[model samples]
Target: MCILVLNRASMTNEQYQSARLSRDSRFDGVFFVAVKTTGIFCRPICPANPPKEQNVEYFTNAHMALEAGYRPCLRCRPESAPNSWAWLGAETSFRRALTLIEQGALNQSSCEELSDRLGISSRYLRQLFKTHLGVSPKKYAQYHQLMFAKQLLHHSMLSISDIGFACGFNSTRRFNDAFKKTLNLTPSQLRRHGLDKEARNVVYLAYRGAYDWQSLLSFYQKRAINGIEKVTDTSYERYVEISGSLAWFKIFADHEGKQTVKIEFEMEDVTKLSTLLTTIRRVFDLDTDITAVESHLNGINHELIVHSGLRLPGVWSTWEAGVRAVLGQQVSVKAAIGQLNLLSESLDYRVSGQLVFPTPGVVSNADLSFLRMPQSRKDTLARLASHLREHCDDSPNNWLALKGIGPWTVNYALMRGQSEPDLFLSSDLIVKKIPKN
Candidate 1:
């Protein structure tokens, strides 16, 4: 496939060249540099000596580079680059499709099935991928699967067979053949050496731009559910349920001043690894392009944004977020957290020595009379849980139709649950109380 160069939507090729020359971390995942002489692609932050501008070409994303017949540079490890929304353009359908693919939509299903989920034809979906990303949707999905498997091989202590299964390969032989054919490297050859000293459950997630971990951590610490979550000086830990089993995941911000954070998770059903990682990314707001956000905010008013690396601190799921918002209504953060703990303790169960949050089904059937909250709030929680169970949709708009749910609850769910970027809290007391200067 012929490669598509940098379009008007993205930065100019000269800017990209300058970024590669300076090894700018901000452009790490925004664009990839492929060397025509060597037939290899590398992240802009790759440490190798820069290739002459005449000999290098730029692709919008790693998939595009791979589709252009360039093997990934082993030194830069393009597989571990931060996932970027910059590469996903303004096409809402395409963006949604990409999100679904990352969440393992194509793992056990076909592109037609994926498009069916999006209410579009498979052919148009392929055209969207081709127009925006310079590759077919299937190729993009396969690239992600392979890249994720490579990342696991180089970082995690998972065995090769387990990695294959986790990445959606049915067997070891198929995994090996596909790995060798695509990446031109055997799984064993790509696995990092000296694994004995590494944390078996640990993997580093890279990000671009400044990340205000302290601020985000403090926000979580103040409102954290005591038994379900633990926020400390340098890390955030929480118990989560994955694939019907109890699991716990933690993020450590001690990257020694690097633009990456380490995550450690332990769970059953390794096949659900992709789903777990997707949730972790959302919870941390990893996919945000903070530079763009800051630029836009700065244009509106320089004083509007206070922190350098501000991000949306998202909840694990819409259901959990809805419950939290319902319990938090007309109460202090401390009181809301207490109610959350009470609800979890009453309905939650323990497995593998970790506590898992109560599911919607559990909350729907239980009479939450033990909590020190108003009856109306309890009814709202029940109605929300029942709506979730019956409709199988988590859109915030749908919640507005339910009784006892209002704009605040829906907006809270949208802001925290989905990490929506644009929201104006005119009805908030604090927002309204601010002096009109």
Candidate 2:
């Protein structure tokens, strides 16, 4: 029953005008409208007086608007807009390239290196970005970094220098220069206009549409790994490992609205912020296009429409998902948790009260005689661990070839592990029991 709008880049002039006039929240990130008179671009939901059709120009993204010489509206903070899910266009290479860009791909390497990693030429990669996003990969990455820096300025207590480095800027001077060049304001001036002083190491993330918090919490609760993760009625807590250091973070929904989630962490290294935020977005499926998902599910089941915001929860890592899937085969959820908890307790690494899941090397080398599972399952686990350790660049096809991993397990892992939306478990007993039309 959800009304699906056309992709932002494809929206007609009239459609953009209508959305802007009405101040529609659904169109917040879809496209931004730049007022020629004011020389500022604002999210569709901005409360400012609407500009006349002649003075307003629609931009597919904030980057495009910036390229057109329009400054971001301070009142609307286009930087705070939920990411446009439509940016993940139809091309596989485009999506993968975008993902890499979000992970600070250009900060560490050139476009040629990135293209080499994606198995495409640098020219073709540039073409993909220009064709779909209307900007080069470098521009997209730069815009994203600036946006993240802006978010930190408005939300965190980090100093301007720290915020710059945290957002992937190589030097404080460069960060200040970029801010002044792009927004006509210094970092400190922007921070002065931010919300109340934030507690150290906390950031808020925005998402579009109505998020089914209870459903998402329940999903994590059912699969919560002892010593590694915990799900409470109000928050989810987990231990995270980065650069050989272990830290904990907690996530809870904002009580004021369903549009944002708060992430509180105790990480000492600010440079890991980009990687951590990317993982959080993936784990929560914050970028899903709920309207498109509902339209696709409309013919199959009416109930699915009612619960369209129920996201596909993702794991912290593919290795964790695969290991959990292997442990869960043929066992009840509770039984699998018991075994997993025991395995974690037996592992070598421990921080606070939490245990880092054993690495592939550790799992493959450790003795499994203590586990109560069958010998065949134990052997399968060993083989999987060894395979993962040896083949660091293994694909899903390689995963499918491993012993004791069936189609169901592989599909389940892909769905949660890689955030693949199209994989459905039609053979699941619960899915099979659903009434047919």
Candidate 3:
């Protein structure tokens, strides 16, 4: 069993009681309240009557509650709670392991393989999981898969078998067995009771706190690639390619009151759903704790924090971000996008009403006579592309070894591509002038 480690700064038992009593949406995913009387756990914002404080115990995460033998509350649907990982206070390895697990690292591979990727021994990896999360990495991965499936079961019109396969269960029997054994509820039963019958190919992803939809949308609107990405006043839609499969998705902000963003998606490969959802969450910065982030930023310098709930809007992939950054060097946003349009028009692949960004291989070999830029800049773009193609490495830190890939280009790619949070654009001309003011 996981030991409860409470500190003054962390959410105390009284705080949990208060938040659940008031049904605070901000604390929805921060912790779970497991009611011993009901033998179930629920999100803090559950609409069901709050259990008596004496009968409830707080678990820092849904996994801990589940492991403690508490089934998820069907009414509250704990699976749909916002997935903010920052508050876990875990080190990089544990966090990376969780990311890998979400990407199905343990679905078809062994724990040894996972530890190998992390450059650690399997024993050490297990130790890490036990110490922090109080469960083996395998158990954590399995719980997440089931949670994702539960989310789909409640929100999507996908068939039971399809949801099973989509969530990485090899067969329907296995999925059903695991679902029943762990959640104490059958998938069919949950679907019958909880599913939104009207939903079709739609999944609502949750988030906590204020969201500056206009600010993030405006940022994307300025740089959206035509035919690939489209930004509207109330929604953002894009054609996406993940793990060699193509899909299209649109996200609407109108689900504001529910504390979730509505995602209407169409994809042929159901198995890729988990990865696609993870990508969507990261790209939209859905998993960030805005309250904590804003508080930290305000402490830095109040003036530096311009907008509330402004998230780090991410590009599709690191490769795409690197290409955009190279094109944007020392240029206005308009100029950079113009060059990008020219480049995309020249080399991008088109199907139906959509266009796929040019691959590193395509950009590396392309002649730059069409782009109206200095020859040196064109050469730099080609060099960066060639390096990425040859090495298959997208990390900005690795890109620093290349010429013309300076701090600004690397930082831009890290910020927009990888959604890295701790970046200081001190080299930027505008940022450099901030101290003068």
TM-score each candidate: 0.94, 0.93, 0.93
Colliding residue pairs in candidate 2? none
The per-model lDDT (C-alpha) reads 0.82, 0.81, 0.85
As a whole number from 0 to 100, the lDDT of residue 236 in candidate 2 is: 92
- Cα lDDT tens digits, model 1, 1-437, are 11223332546777877778888776778788999999999998899999999999988788888778888888888987887875444688898898889878898899999999888999999999888887888888888888888888877889999999888888999999988888888988877442335658777788877889999999999988767899998999998887677777889984878777888988787888888888888889887767766776788999988879988999998888889889988777888888998888877666676677777788888888988888988989999988888765568878999889988888888888877767765666556778998
The candidate maximizing lDDT is 3
Tens digit of per-residue lDDT, candidate 3, span 1-437 = 12222231465677778788888776778788999998999998889888888999988779999899999988888888888654346778888788889988898899999999888999999999998889999999899999999999999999999999988899999999999999988999999999897899999998977899988888999999987889988899988776667788999984947778999998878888888888889999998888777776777888867778888899988888988988888888899999998898888765444687877788888888899988888988989889888876446898888887899989989998888888988888677766675
Off by over 4 Å in 2: 1-3, 299-303, 306-308, 351-354, 433-437
Candidate 1 regions with alpha-carbon error over 4 angstroms = 1-8, 87-89, 192-197, 351-353
Global local distance difference test of model 3: 0.85
Residue 291 accuracy (lDDT) in model 1: 71
Ranking by lDDT, best first? 3, 1, 2
Q: Pick the candidate with the highest TM-score.
A: 1
Clashing pairs in 1: none
| Model 3 TM-score (2 dp) | 0.93
